[model samples]
Target: MRLFVTLNFLPCSVFPSPSFPYTTQEEESGVIANHLTKHFSSSCYLSTFLLLIMSQRTLLIPLSSFFIAHLLISGAVSTTFTLTNKCGYTVWPGILSNADAPALSTTGFALQKGESKTITAPASWGGRLWGRTYCSQDSTGKFSCLTGDCGSGKLECSGTGAAPPATLAEFKLDGYGGMDYFDVSLVDGYNLPLLVVPQGGSGQNCTSTGCVVDLNDACPSELKVTSTGGESVACKSACEAFRSPQYCCNGAYGTPDTCKPSSYSEIFKNACPRAYSYAYDDKTSTFTCASADYQITFCPGPNTSQKASQETNSENTDTNTNTPLINSTMVYEGALSQNGASPSLYGSVLGSHVTAAIVSFTVAIWQWRQLF
Candidate 1:
């Protein structure tokens, strides 16, 4: 291409300049134009090189093995987190208890060293940036990953051959009008892996206003998001009491120890800053959790951290002022005069004090209502 272009330009410069002396300036200008075109074309490609610098690329073959190894280990860690937090077990409401727990043990599947099985990934892990779990060695120098990559429903979970077989579970709540959106609190990273392939609403970009976007982003106030579509997300409210370095899954206070963010922090802040609630869900136009369970109980959450501190202080004051009076038997005797005796001053004035105390007690309790 260069040769041809040079050939055309040279002839114009040579032939026209030599044979037609009057055309010398025109040929010179033509030569400059040709040079300028080539220069601009080269400059235009600078962006391509800039892209190469901005995007990372390496000896990928060597790193592929490393990435798979990380996935194997991360996958095991993921499974551990999944069961304890992401994985759901039935709970006794109001009174906190895991009465309805998963079976203690089961012999279903295990991955051995150098062994591999094809496995289907969770709803997340469906984008160009995210990598799928591969059929590789398991962590702990023991077993391998799924026989094939994660996509098909073939592989089994591994645990470095030291851990027991993993148990998977899903947690979800129904929405008002029965329309459902996956809970951000239940999934691993709010099932962020969904963004990779088939899980990410199938490559659909969720925005602030579009219906397609609302399918995932439209959380209102009256309806909060805790669990969703068989995945674990953030739901700390029902679980957290007051703030003490508690970790939240997505929006709700999560299982006591894990903290996973669903998307960019700012994006999450913009959509949900105060809490993950039913009213916060813009879909139904409410700002709270869908289930009464989200509200009826006084669950602790991010907000509760500060609120708890205030409650503790108030409780201490109440204990100092009111508990002694209630504990005093002297007051009880004043209420029940001895052997039908005539009303005494102790009974008359003290009885009036008790009634006044009850009224004051009710109002004091109200001062602490926000803690709930």
Candidate 2:
């Protein structure tokens, strides 16, 4: 009798409509339920039904708990990134997702002055984005850029990361403790002013962060990357410029304690405090947020050009004092409001989810014994 009942009811509730689509977390759950129904045979249903019947009323509790736990683990929220070009010149943006993350829609695209493009990413995605400057196609239809080039020889970088000497905006969405980690890094180098502003997110460290000052004009002569026309195109990091283990933070200097910031890194740090100047500069440079979209802008400030010139002029004068290279308060006032919750909150939230899963599994096991 128990076997008969198990076989009859298993097909009824376990399988769902095969037509169900999956995109968001809720839809994905529905699809999973549907898939289970379609694949399981009547005998399988009977076995499940017999177990449930023998387990009595308590069996439903664990089964339901298992489904809920599954949903919590599998469901994910997507993130959107809007790329805007506020520069006076064109910027070709390049994207490279991490090896484990899903690929984005486009790896590279052109953004003319005052243009914007939006890209959507699936949950738990991680990648870096950067701008390419002075790009042009040769007579042979080969594409290339002077700075931040991915060397793909085409518009799309595909899976290639940006070449060194380029400012980078890196992101890991839905990361540790259900929080998103983001930062603008100049550790590779600096080619242009970049800003990352989180939207619709909350976290104590969640705010706008980037190297907004144009460092090319005021870049140290030894570290400056110049174009063929004698234009300062980008700034190279101490590591890239010298390749010393002390500067690269490798070999004997691999540890954080040994890898101290150099004079060249200090120049970038003084100019852009929120951006990563060296490999170990994480405490001040990294930021976290929860449930947020992001806006990435090239040349963000209104008086960017004038400010660049002013920064260049003031660089030599403020060599002794601790004054930052640019007035961040004036440049970041309206759009760069810094406010949010701490990362610990996200950790607690994740802990609760994990606890719930463990409890659900335990309850199911105990109930199974009672039923048997």
Candidate 3:
């Protein structure tokens, strides 16, 4: 006898369908066998289907908690693409960077798609996040994305927010004329500056990385420059002996990265020309030597009275004091700053700032993903 048959034959209280007419236990067994025919064979697959999907559509059990879990998982650690500006070398928080739960997200919300947000906390908080990366016995254990591509891989990038990876269309750069990135003018800071407009004159949407321009090399070259408003123009010469009368580009002062003929050609001409010093003071644009010390100062406007007094005082001051005073105009010599060095502090600062940009882009993505 089969085990199920033996169970039914024994004193068992499992209730059978009451609609069946069974005067004897043997008759009941036959009824059970007949009724089970549709389930015992290939049709048994229906039982599993019914359990998973009620009425062939609805789930047999509710998944409310799973959706909640999804929200929590998304919000927990979203910063992937991050950039910092201070030194620019902040790396994406690695497994070693976080001691416990990494404070990766900068913002608290994940938007509809590619929208991004920012958040800022004390360095101490960052330290707290950094501390957690190693101490697995502390509390929350380390987590690696299943695909191992959450931070900066093919599937993900250290973009600008803690959000889900954006679909192509969602990465709309509103108000960005089109340029993606550029090296910031050292006049501002050695940095890879973010672009706000489509760089190509065509104004078409940017699709690739070709839009960025490196501006860090702008200085230390012999190229003559003018900055009138906010734009720059350059005048390079062809040789060291070439006087100002033979103004064009040469290795005498500036780098030759420029492809312009060894004559006058524009470095930044698309924007407002007069605003840049290179364009305005074209004649006096050359810097003889980067080793030659020069002061970096916003020329005090003529409208300022404080500068006028300082200028008059410098001119009237005694020349015997070491710093030769001019005839009452205004020029003072101050101690050298750290930015004047062998490699120049500007290069290191620029490196750090660029690293920071990468960090910011990463953290921003993580922040948004966690928030929503």
Candidate 4:
């Protein structure tokens, strides 16, 4: 997803409160006219000043609406992320918030076969979510997964990204252009098949993106993550397998021109055409929408329709009770969050600076008119 971080001015002086009838400019102008007419008794000056006040008032309505519209639009809207596990076995979903961003409720949670869980992401939240396969908890409460284990040794990721060879669903909200960007990324690697679908959003290329192919079954021997039973559990990225500049796309080979897709990434790209195969794969993999909820499904293929009996688990998760089917989806309501606009979109960077200037200008007009 596109990451957007901007600092812009809030037009506080432009938008007056409902209780205050006149806008800042109009109020200042009226006060000045009243003072000048009362003290100096300057009828001609008062007439000219009132005319200017009338002109300013005429512009207030449309300008007020414009600023108000922007204010509403710029405010952050909560987005829902619904995670479903369609695999035959249980899957533990791991969440890692971006550095310095607020964490979602329960960084790690379990979903039985065909079960789903929902989480509300606040505004401008950037994070990655991945499923852990074949997880087991010891008597000491130390949990570990054969695939996508974040090394936390517990269900909670605790603000840690998944290890290599794990399929990842990444997102950043209120991104550049005021759109939410999301994508299924294999830049790290692939464990289970997954998909990210946008719901009720408007924009180009807001379509679903995922890797339906079971890369583990077809993983190359050199990049295979094997289980205790000697079966391939996940497919490791070339960078993780080789740690070379060509595979990792680092240093001298960081540029797109220098770091062309290797045979391994090409395999991933071929399997998942709409997912990120390499570090530079942005144009095709990245998807954006203005405001939309998303469904992230693991193992989202033909066999996904099969439902296994829900097993008794001791984890406390708000299971998707509305639907008994494994493939059913749920939407959650989130609180409103406000995001700042890019200064480049307008001219000012600091909202306080703009407010100060407007207040100063208004005071100057008030004082000058009172002196007359």
| lDDT tens digits, residue span 14-34, model 4 | 332122111111111222111
Which ten contiguous residues of candidate 2 have the minimum total lDDT?
20-29
Q: In what order do the candidates fall by lDDT, top score first?
A: 2, 4, 3, 1
The local distance difference test score of model 4 is 0.62
Of 2 and 3, the candidate ahead on TM-score is: 2
Give the whole-model CA lDDT for all candidates, comma-separated.
0.19, 0.68, 0.20, 0.62
TM-scores, in order shown? Answer: 0.18, 0.71, 0.16, 0.65
Clashes of 4: 2
Better of 1 and 3 by TM-score: 1
A best-first ranking of the candidates according to their TM-score comes to: 2, 4, 1, 3
Tens digit of lDDT per residue, candidate 1, span 1-372?
Answer: 011100000111111111101111111122211111111111000000001111243211222332333233221211111110010111110010011212212212332212322322221111101111122233544423221122222232211110101000111112111111222211111111111001111001111110001111222222223322321122123112122222223233232224433233223334332212211222221121111111111111111111101112322221111111111121110122245443332343244334434433343344224324
The parts of candidate 3 lying over 4 Å away from their true place are 1-60, 68-77, 80-83, 87-226, 229-372
State the lDDT of candidate 3 residue by residue for 1-372, as single tens digits: 111100001111122312312121111122211111111111000001112322344332223333333223212122122221111111122111122223434311211111322333221111111000000111343332211113332212223221111000001110111111111111111112121111111111111111022222342244333333322222222221233312222223232233222222233322112111121222211111111111111111111111101122333222112221111222222322234332332343233334434443344344334534
- Top TM-score hit: 2
lDDT of 2 by residue, 227-299 (tens): 7767677899988888787887766776677788899999898888888888777678877777788999898
Query: Which stretches of candidate 1 lie above 4 Å from their native place?
Result: 1-135, 138-154, 157-181, 184-264, 267-372
TM-score (C-alpha, index-matched) for candidate 4: 0.65
